[model samples]
Target: MQFIDLKTQYARIEPELKVRIQAVLEHGQFILGPEVQELEARLAEFVGVRHCIGMSSGTDALLAAMMALEIGRGDEVITTPFTFIATAETIALLGARPVFVDIDPVTYNLDPAKIEAAITGRTRAILPVSLYGQCADMDAINAIAARHRLPVIEDAAQSFGASYRGRRSCALSRIGCTSFFPAKPLGAYGDAGACFTDDDALAQALREIRNHGQDRRYHHLRLGLNARLDTLQAAILLAKMEIFPEEVESRARIGARYTELFQARGALGTDVGGAPVLTPYVHPHNLSVYAQYTLQVEDREAVAAKLGEQGIPTAVHYPIPVSEQPVFHGGLLGADYPVSAAVARRVLSLPMHPYLDEATQERIVAAVAKAAGL
Candidate 1:
């Protein structure tokens, strides 16, 4: 079975996708086209935000948000080390330091309690990643940011359709960024992402930042990068967005089924143990899109190898903590973020998508159970 079943999704939306792309081609307004604006508006409305600035990629979206907040040159952005490198890379790219925080062992998201301890004089923003399509504790994180008067940027790359409490993931923070990478919950055909915020000034700043800091044509207001989203990608995303809510619901159903199946077998117990495979922990106030149906498995390498032998694809979302990566080696290794380190070793992502079939899922579960020697 395909890991994400993008082919099936494309088949389902083929007619609409073709129509959208045809319109973009017919218009011949590729750069900052009408479709781009339409997508931004629709996305903003979906996320309950006042503005959405589409960008070249998720990385650029994060960079644009940071630039808007003036988070650079000795500034520190607090985040978890369990996420993809882009979370910390964007901060370091701006000459700012990424203060690593340990994750909540269960959620694999930045621990809210540990965030305050990481803040220092240079702390400019708290960038919490909504890892594995589940939002981090935004309420607590926002409260801490409020106390410190710092901006919070939600790295909602994996959590576009996810919800925290009654609010959407991208609308929960000062500025939220999400990827349209093909693997994300809500994906475009190619590289694209958007930044969302209610603050008008920050919204304008982000727009300028995405267009080389230009307030208008030939008017350079600040140094920035060319991070405009392509018209084709925008059109494709607009089509995808039409069915995104349904897909999210489908994913949650699949996730719940997987939880039930695994929980039936003691092999998927929550606590760490000899035959335990821990299902992802979703916070009570949060709804996960299950971008990846990850589980904490002991002897992860062995389990993966065995699954591979059985023609069942399994992957580790992260094998090494970001703090231990070679890029950050010899620089920011002072703290012992035990939870991040521990989760990095055990976390394994199973094939998950809205279109994942029941037969395929059953086969996968059987393979994993056999691999765990259950």
Candidate 2:
């Protein structure tokens, strides 16, 4: 089965998608077109934010957010190491050091307890990633940032549709960013992203930062990049939005079913070599979109191989922590991130999508159970 059944999703929205794309083609305003503005407005409304600045890619969105906050050389941004490279890469790209923090062993997100200890005089901002489609503890993180008088940027790339408490993912912090990569919960056909904020100044700054720092044509207010989201992608996303709420519900249902099936098969706490096979630990206050239904198992490679033999596809969300990446020179500035190190070796993702069916899910879980020797 496909890891993410985009083909099925496309078929469901085909007619509306065609109409939206056709309008974009007919209008011919490819860059920052009408569709882009409309999509931005809708997304902002969905997230309960004042502004949503569409970007060319999630990476650029992070970069623009940092730029808007004036993060640069000699500055430090506190963040977790157990996330996609883009989380820390953008910080480093801006000549800012990414101070690594360990993750909560249960949620595999930045451990708020460790965040305060990492802050120093040079700390410019706090960035927390919502990994595996669930939000990090934004309330705690925001409190810490408030104490430090720093901005908090929530990297909601994997959790655009998720909810923390009663608020949406992209509306929980000073600046929130999310990706529209094809595999995300609310993905577009191609690369796209957005930055959301309630601060009008930061919103305007983000909009300018994504468009060569121009407030208007030929007016360069600050240095920026050509990171505006394509009109076609916005059109496609707008069409996708029509059914996104339903898809979010499906994802939550499917995720719960996967956990329920694994537990019923006696695979929840079963030992897989050294480590026990563990399901994702979502916090009670958060509603995850379940972008990837991941598990922690010992001998991950062996487990993945066993699943593959049964014609089931599996993936590793991340095999290496950013702190251990070669570019970071092996734990940059010589800090220890034991939790990130451990999680990196055990995390494995299985097929997850809103369209996944019960029978297919049973087959996948049975494969996992057998693979784990349960």
Candidate 3:
């Protein structure tokens, strides 16, 4: 089974995808074309935000957001270490330090309780990741950011369609960024991303930043990067948006079904529940899109190998915490992330996609049960 099953999704949206792509080809405005504006508008409306600035990639979106906020050398950004490196890499790219914080073992997201303690005079922002399609505790994190008078950027690359307390993922913070890397829950055919915000000034700044800080033709307003999204990607994303809501529902259903199937075998447990496998624990207030239905399994290597033997594909969302990456070695001083460290060693992802049939899902789950020796 394909880990993400993008092929099935492509088939589902083939007609619309072709029409959109053809239109882009006919129009020949490959860069920031009309499709890009249309996509930004649709994304903004979907997220309940006032602005959505299309970008070249999720990494660029994060970089542009930080640039607009003026986070640079000598600054610090507090973030979780249990996520993909892009979350922290963008922070470091701006000549700023990424202050590592332990995650909430249950949700695998930034622990809000530890956020305040990490804030210092140099802390410019709080960057929280909505890992594995569920949102972080934005309300609690926002409260802390309010106290510190800092901006909060939700790295929502994995959670574009998720809901947190009735709000969408990309609408949950001062500046929310998400990827469209063909594998995200709501993705384009190629590299693309967007920055969402309610603040008009920040929105304007983000738009300019993505176009090399140009407010008017050739008039550089500030130092910026060429982070604009391609029109073709925007067209493809627009077509996918037509069925995104339904896909989100399917993802939620499939994720729940996976948990139920695993539990029926008495194989499911919490992060610290001592059972051989731990299922994802989403907060009641949030509706996860389940970008990946991950499990924390004992004897990870053996379980993966067993699954492989049965022709079942499994992946590791992350095997190394961002804080422990060689590039940042001896850098994030005084870091002691026991939770992220532990999760890194144990996490495994199963096949997850809206199109996964019930029969296929059962087979995959059974393989996992046997692999974990449940």
Q: Is candidate 1 or candidate 2 better by lDDT?
A: 2
Tens-place lDDT digits, model 1, residues 1-374: 67888998999889999999999999899999999999999999999999999999999999999999998889889998988999999999999999998987778888898999888999999999999999999999999999999999999999999999979989999999999999899888789999999999999999999999999999999999999999999999988988999998999899988887887776555553323338876767789999899987779999999989877888888988888888997876558888788778888899999988788888898888888776
Q: For each of the candidates, give the backbone clash count.
A: 0, 0, 0
By summed lDDT, the worst window of 10 consecutive residues in model 2 runs over 268-277
lDDT digits (tens) for residues 329-349 of candidate 2:
944645888988988999999
Which residue segments of model 3 deviate by more than 4 Å? 270-277
With a 3 Å backbone cut-off (N, CA, C), the pairs that clash in candidate 2 are none
Assess each prediction's global lDDT (C-alpha) against the native: 0.90, 0.92, 0.92
| Whole-model alpha-carbon lDDT for candidate 2 | 0.92
Candidate 2 structure, TM-score to reference? 0.97
Q: How displaced is residue 101 in candidate 1, in Å?
A: 0.8
Residue range with the least summed lDDT across 10 consecutive positions in model 3:
268-277
